[model samples]
Target: MSIEVGSKVQGKVTGITNFGAFVELPEGSTGLVHISEVADNYVKDINEHLKVGDQVEVKVINVEKDGKIGLSIKKAKETQQPQRPRHNGPRNNRNDQRNQNKTESFEQKMNRFLKDSEDRLSSLKRNTESKRGGRGARRG
Candidate 1:
């Protein structure tokens, strides 16, 4: 059977790696499930979530022209919660800014970052100067 993108299929884990796990799909085809796509949360170690000979349902994310199939285990499982709409465009309107606090423009974000960095630098200088006996300490 040919594997298509966005289709869920059952497969057996044939091997495991630091980055991902290899699964043998139908018709003897093998696909790789990346470490990040193995679970919903952060997956530091793939071995903690999967092992050899384990059967898992994975969704085919991509079928490359080079015969490489990218699979995702998390996408195969159904979620009851509604997905939030992604904001890909620039948030220039008032409604977009009001809806999300992170919708600041490039200049606004740069100003905020500069102010925070200056504050941190001043605080660090104050602490370090006091520890080193201030500016006019006598050398004995």
Candidate 2:
């Protein structure tokens, strides 16, 4: 099968190494799937996730003129949540907008912040009783 970028295709995992997995596409064509492309998140280890003989759906990322195809497993899965349908009327939710307008005045917020800061300082002072020595006074 001809592989093109963005094409989703099924292939068999032929080999597994520390770095990547070799996938044999239909028609006996093969491509290298880098470790980064193995998952949607950080792929710390590829072998733990895939083994030889496992069939996988992968997206073709690149097809070079020299016939080297780069594949990605992460791109094969669409991560986006399905889009929500828009309401067909004006957004007259005055309650939400009014609540967004700060009910607490700036002065009240500042007072609360300063009081919290004092409590945090006292807590830090009480907890840090390691009794460690400090470096000697430095000279200019």
Candidate 3:
């Protein structure tokens, strides 16, 4: 069958290589299943996942100018759009964890405090030392 982008189709695995697999669809049209499109899980070896003559469902992700289709097995099985898990009832541990994480780490706070204190102390020492008439050169 002619495949279009975003359309899911059934195919038989015709060949497998290090890079991807070739699948022949109903109308004898062939498409490349890139290694990345083989599954939802990582596919380290394509042979382990598919063999010649195996039936598989794949989604057509692209159709090249030459009419060759780029297929994705992972996409064909994707029926539901992922939904953010719902939070029911009142917020609790999450907020507490957020509050705890909101504060600067102890080391950061201490470093900031030490830097400010050093600047203030240095300014104070300079002021006191300047009052001792140390600005200009003394009489030779």
Best by TM-score: 1
Question: Candidate 1 lDDT, tens digit per residue, 50-70?
Answer: 999999999999999999999
Worst 10 residues of 2 by lDDT: 130-139
The TM-scores, one per candidate, come to: 0.63, 0.56, 0.57
Give the runs in model 3 whose Cα sits over 4 Å from its true position.
80-140
Clashes of 3: 1
The lDDT of each candidate is 0.87, 0.80, 0.84
RMSD of each: 7.1, 10.5, 15.5
Candidate 2 C-alpha lDDT tens digits along 1-140: 56778888999999988888999998899998999999756778897889999999988999988998899887787543443444434453434444575787888768867997999897666556433332332344
Query: What is the lDDT for 58 in model 1?
Result: 94
After superposition, the stretches of candidate 2 with alpha carbons farther than 4 Å from their true spots are 79-140
Cα lDDT tens digits, model 3, 22-51, are 999878899999999987767899999999
Among all windows of 10 consecutive residues in model 3, the one with the lowest summed lDDT is 83-92
The total of clashing pairs for model 1 equals 0
Relative to the true structure, candidate 2 has a C-alpha RMSD (angstroms) of: 10.5
Shift in Å, residue 107, candidate 2: 21
Error of 1 at 48 (Å): 0.6
